[model samples]
Each structure stands twice: as C-alpha cells, then as structure tokens.
Target: MQNLQAKGLSALVAISILFAGTGCQSNSASATPPESSKTLDTAPATAAPAELPIISERAPTPMGEESVRGAPADPSAGTALAQLETIAIKGRAPKTGYDRDVFGQGWKDLDRNGCDARNDILNRDLTNTVHKPGTHRCVVASGVLADPFTATTIHFVRGNATSTAVQIDHVVPLSDAWQKGAQQLVPEQREAFGNDPLNLLATDGPTNGAKSDGDAATWLPPNKSFRCEYVAIQTAVKAKYGLWMTQAEHDAIQRILTSSCPDQPVPTDEGGVAVPIAAEPAPVPETVQDTPTAPVPGPVSGPDVVYKNCTAVRSAGVAPIRVGDPGWDTKFDRDGDGVGCE
Candidate 1:
C-alpha cells in the first residue's frame, strides 16, 4: 500500500508540468504589439500642381494721351460702337486713280513739330530710342519696337534694307480711305488724312504686307490679344476722316469692338496733345477805297492785307512761298533770299 501511493504522487507531478508548458507556449504565440508606434517612412500620394501662364516682360503701358477719341467714354465700347455705327455702309470704291502722290508729298511735318511724321511715330512707339546723329531727335537711329501687329520684340536699325522691316502702316490704308470718302476731300484734307498719326503705325514689315489695304474684315493682328486695340484704332481713323465701311467690314469691326472692347476709347490726336484748329483770318474784305493817281503803295498796309508768322504760314498752307506770292511776307524769310516763307 505504501509503494502504490508514491507512484501516484509522481504521475500527478508530471501532469502539472505538462499543463504549465502548454500555457507558456500559447501566451508567447498570441501576444499583440501596442497601437502607438511610428513605423511610416513617407506621406501618402497626391495630385500635381497646375502650370502658370506666359507673360511678356516688355509689355506696353496703356497710354492715355494716345487716346484718339478725346475724353474717354463712360463705357468705351458703347462710344466706339456708336462712332462705328455712324459710318455709312457702302461698297468699296474703284482704285482707279489712287496715286500715292494724291495725298501730297509723303511725311510732311503737318503738325509743324520739326520732325516728319515717320520719325514722330517712331519716337512715340519705340523704347530706348537713339536719335540719328545731327538729326536733333528728328530721325530714329536704333530702338526697340514692341510690335502690335505680331506681338514680337523687334530691334529697329534704320537702313534701306532693315528699314523696310519696320514699315509705317496706315491703320486705315490710303487706298481704303480713298474708296471710302477721301476722294471728296480737298488736297489739304487729303494730306492731313495721309500723315495723321492716328491713321499710321510703325509695324512689322511682313505683317503689314500681309494686311495691305485690308479693312478689319479681311485681316486682324496675328497677335490675338492685340486685335481689340487694332480694331479700335481703325474705327477711330474712319470716324476722324469721315470714311465709310463695307457690310463685311462693319460686321467684322462690330464683332471685335462691341463684343471684345466695347469700352475701348478712341485714340485722341495720334500720339501728341490735341491742337485746336486755328480760325482763319477774316477774309480780307473787298476794298472800294480809291487808289491814288500816283503810286500810293508803301509796304502795302490795309484791311485787305493778310501777313502772318512763319508757323501760321506753314500750318495753313504749304512751305517755301516766294517773295511776291499771294501770302508771302519778308518777315518770315530766315535766309533773306528772293523766297520769303521757305
């Protein structure tokens, strides 16, 4: 009975050992990690940023003095459209007698501003302009042109070959003006129309060629952004000179101006301050006073006389009036030759 009790105690001890070992193995296998750990190497993926627009470093300033239509319209588009509306709608006239000379000698100092129209426009439109040597700022030697027609930067150097590359364009081409209403204008009016800075622009040569005599209907600036301003200028020129437009030309202009630039102001007097037209001297009243039997003329002084300063002479009429001509006076002769108003 003592031997049997000892064996039974040993078996109980072995079973207890086996149960403890199984519990330890199960605990080790089932253990879990803590939730508050930092194992990530990078942030999650996201969409890329958008691209920006292209902007020119040499963009031109919007010049107020260059406004050709005088005081700005409250809504430039309405004023421009109203002006455009006034233009008579008609078919293009025949180009039969459209001689360039009909407008008068090209490039007159019509404004009497010392510089010819070409140089005046160049100085107005170009940046960093260098004047021709000895020309006293009357001629452009070199400059940077922010060409409106092509929206490109051109380095302008004055020479026969290079000069043509920067030609002066008539915004309202002379031929177009002639057909519209310029045929009815007198010689002086024609000259004014031709050299009016409002009508002219210094533009890219190739572009000008492509746009020869084309109204707004046929051509527009290749630079899409510049089309509104270009159309505005054309409308202003047509308005100033009483020129008309074709059905297609009117429609095209209205589309651009009314839709795009309805508030675009007419450019004032080309690029300069506007000058008021001078009143003509009261027509010399016919004199019925009796002439002396003997020669009674001493420098020819009377209500019948019309002597004016040199500026008035140049502004009112052409230059180089001779000593005995209708409007000549010895006072205007700078060189004191037989010619008085040269």
Candidate 2:
C-alpha cells in the first residue's frame, strides 16, 4: 500500500510537470498569462525533468480558495457559445480528448515540435517508442505498457501495440467536459483542452474508447475495481476547470464513492494525473469563426442505448425495439449508449 501510495504521489507530480509544461490555461491567444505559463517563468533555466512523480487520492479542493499556484477563477466566462455539442462516436472518449483539427488546423504542434502531446505521452508510457529524431513524433514502434490499472500492473508486450493498449485518456472526457462548462471556453482554451498535457494519461485504449463521451455518472472503467480512482480523477478535472456538473452527474459520482470509498476526497488537478481524497461535496472554451453547425442529432434509442441498469432494460425487451417503432421512443434507450442488451 505504501509503495502504491508513493507511486500515486510520484505520478501526480509527473502530471504536474506536464501541466507545468504548458502552464495551466493554455490559451492560444496571449491576452493574459495562463497558470501553466507562470510556472514557466519560475521553473529553473534548466531543461524540464525527464519524468516527474505521481499522486493518489484527490483532496476535494475547497471552493473559492486559492490553490498553491494561485489559479484564478474561470475567467471571461469563456467566449460566447452556440448550442452545446456532444460526440456521438463509437468506442470511448480518447484518453486525451485532443485533436488539433477540432480547435482548427494547427495548434497542437505549436513550436512545430513534431512530437505532439499524443506522441510525447506514448513515448513516456510505452516501453520502447521508436521516435523521429529531434521532434519525437514519427512513432515507428511502441514499448511495452507498464502501469497499474487497479491492483494489477498492466504489462503489455511490444507486439500488442494497439493504441487501445497505450491510449492517452483525458482524465475527463471532452463530451462530459463540454457539459461541465467546457462550452464556455474561448476558442483557444478549447483547443488546449484537446491537447494540454495536463488532462491526459496513458491508459487502456479499449476501456478509454468504451468510456466514450459519458461523464463519471454515466460510465466508468470496465474494470469495476477502479471506480473510486476514476471518479476521483473526474472530480479533479471538473474542479480544476471550475466546471459544474449536472445534479444527475454529481449524484452518479456520489453513488460511486459510496459504493467504493465513501470518504474519498475531491482530488487535485495540480497535474493531469488523478488522486484519491477523503470525501467532499460534489462539484473550457474554445472559439473559431462560425464553422457550420455540427448538426445536432436527436437523442439515441433502441439498440444504440447502453443502459446503466441492463437488467431494467432486459425486462422491457419482450416488446423489443424496432426502427421507427412509435413507442420505441421510450424504453431502455434513455441515455442512449446503444447497447441496451449489454
């Protein structure tokens, strides 16, 4: 337990280093300084550390208080936002919800550093990442994945290089992020949300995909064992950005903590890594010229829904769901995860 605790702390520190790299609030615009940028000012002249420590247990940070870094309150109320959007993609939300293109064509590689955050995290997480010389982007090979998911240290061989094995999961998925106030961000901050090193971690790709865009309330790691840590991580991210969760989302998290460690703390986002905490109350912007609306689709239904309570769904399956079936409107398709049977 002590060793795990140490590793957790070390990991949190490692996350801090990453966030510290971009300096919190990675805005593309230079209107004001970002939290992470300030660290840049204070970090010694030496190069950044090769690696940093991690932490465990998210201590629910008190509301309205200054964190050690003096992070400011969510500024600008973010830029004006249109109808909020959510990802309807398959699999789960990528560990690091970043896409240079999402914020517009070229922000991820800012310094033209070929090794973008994705590759950087891969290089750090994988056993032997075959990288492009100076930039580190061109990942020709990936090393074994060595990290603990729950009590198990996940070990992957070189042959199992599927990203599902070495994914960069956002501590907080982007869709859940949008719901939690990410929609308020100025365009630049939204782009940073996709790539900021602070919110990402090399995690199980498939599980990451499965989590998709659901929030802590709707989904969790397949490994039910890690629920506490996952919720703690989610809490940290939401708290860090001063994002607010729907009452349902908050209730979902409370359920998990009660089911797991009822006394867990809210954790910290000092870095992207998630930590556990005793217990506490529950808890991005981006801009761009008006791109065509993403076409708000209707809510999901029938076979497309993944109900939190599968039994409840199965019981109602006798009538079954069919396309355009009038009452098909109701049924287990409530949240619409698309796999009601499962």
Candidate 3:
C-alpha cells in the first residue's frame, strides 16, 4: 500500500512541473510580438517624415530677374511698379524762363495727321463726335466726353462761349514738366512733350485750371476710380520724357500703384515725334482806308490786327479767319481746328 501511495505522489509532481514550463514559454512568446505587429505599433512615427515635402512645396519662388535688395519682387515683370523702381527721384527745378511759348505758340500738328494736337485729343477722347462741315473731320464740332477728372459726362460744343468747358489737360502739366526735367530738353523735344497725345486728356475746364502746374504730390483726379490710371499715365509720360519726380511725388505715385493697382502696366501709345520748330510767318501789309469808316465787310488782311473777341472780329468784317490767315490766333480759334472766327 505504501508503494502505490508513493507512485501516485510521483505522478502528481511530474504533472505540476509540466504545467510550470508551459506557463514560462507562453510569457516569453507574448513579450516579443511578431515583426508585422511591431511595425504597426510604430506606424505614427514613420508618418512624421512624409509631411516635410508638403511644407517645402508652399514656399514662394522668385520670378523673372532678381529685384532690388530688400524690395519685394514685382508681382509681374515689366509692370508699372517695376518701371517706377527705375525712375530717378530728385528735387524740382526752378520755373525761371518758363513760358507757354517756350513749349510752342499753341497746339501743333506734331503727329502730321492733318490735325492740330488740341483737335486730335478732342476727337480721340470725345464720344459720338460731330466734326465741322469743311474741316475733314479734323474739327470736333460737338461731342460727349466722359471726363476723367470730374467723373462726369460733359457735352462739348465748338464755340467761343462753350469750347472752354472741355479743355485739354496735360497729364504732366507744362509748368510741372518745366520744373522737373523739361528745361534741359531742346525746343523740338519740349514741343513734342507738350503735344504728345499720351499726356493729353479732355477734362473739365475748371478741373484743368485747378490742376494747373500741380504734380502727383500736389493734385490728383477727383475721380477715385480713375486715380490709378491717371497716375500710371503720369508715370509713363515722365519716364518717356526723361523727367524726374520729387520725393513726395514719387512716394505718392508708388503708394497709389502698390495699394490700388499692383499690376497696372505703364500706358503705351504713339508718342509725339520731335519736329523742327516752324518760324512765324511774315506779317502782311494792311491796306488802311484813309477815311476809317465802318470796317470793310471781308476777311482781314493784316497779321498785326488783334481782335478783342469774335464779335470784334465780326465788326472788323473778318467773321471767318481761317488758320494761317492774317489776324489769326488760338483765342479766336474756339473750335481749335486751326481756324479762327468761323
């Protein structure tokens, strides 16, 4: 009976030892997971490096040639802002020796288009224009102007009483140009600068007068919407004529271009070609009547005659003094067709 009892005890001890070994192997296997399971646990860490490319892709690249140091690259190459960067800044010169005649006596036919500068601008800017009957459409008899200075529609009629209502405004006023860099230009160049179509605008007469001799620093268009275009035109003119701007003027123009129209291009057109300044025609002899009675009824024949007004011209019997005729003057040429008292 003792032997049998001992055998049972031995069997029980062996079973206990087997169960302990199995538990140890199971713990070892669980502590070290499979290679695929380990990769899944570290998946988030691996994904971190993938985001680096996305960040680098958003960086800005340079455009065209490199710009001036410390300045932002031009949004577009050859834009007004880029052009503005090229212009020189300087103090304004004196107005000494400045005169309207220095630019030339009056509007000239610089374009050689069979029309004077004033009439050309009038024809170009005014809508629905009606020209005089015998002026080959060179004369703007009547028209509607979308005046940029005042931002209003103006009815333009060719007459002494109403012609002044829509006057041609120089984008860079003559006096302002004279003070900037025009004094150095030759007479032909100055004349071309004065008559260039790119510099002319048919604006409200009062506005033109108000803006007389004012630069971008001193004056701007009353029409806020047109201010960008106005400044752009001024910049182009100054650049074309090799004119410099005051610090204030340059800053004003730069402010407008950057804040309002960053991409505005410098305006381009057929600029005036320099031509030889024509000499004044020789004066013709006046046939004075010994008895100075009522003025004779016909065209006046004396270059020295200065009529006070169109009515005076009529009283002198020179109701229609064609351009180049004796006694002809721009003041009498209300329609600006190179004809006076018509």
lDDT of each: 0.66, 0.46, 0.71
- In the order shown, the candidates' Cα RMSDs to the true structure are 17.0, 27.7, 16.8
Lowest summed lDDT across 10 adjacent residues in model 2 is found at 79-88
lDDT of 2 by residue, 143-251 (tens): 5554424333444322322333445677676655654455555555566666654566667655655565567656766667667656665665555555665555666
lDDT of 1 by residue, 1-342 (tens): 888999999899999999999998888666633333322324455658877866323212222123232234445345666778888887766554665557765477777767777777777777777876786666777788889989898988876345656777888888678777777667777788777887778888778867866788878889988887777778877877677888888999899887787776655554542323424422222222222223213343344546676445544443334445566666655322233332
Q: Which ranges of candidate 3 are over 4 A from the true structure?
A: 1-77, 271-342
How many clashing pairs in candidate 1?
11
Comparing 1 with 3 on lDDT, the higher-scoring candidate is 3
Query: Candidate 2, 29: how far from true, in Å?
Result: 83
Candidate 3's residue-wise lDDT over 91-162, tens digit each?
Answer: 766565666557876688876767787877777677677877887677778888888888898998887557
lDDT agreement of model 2 with the native: 0.46
Worst 10 residues of 1 by lDDT: 284-293
* Best-matching candidate per lDDT: 3
- Give all TM-scores, in the order shown: 0.59, 0.43, 0.60
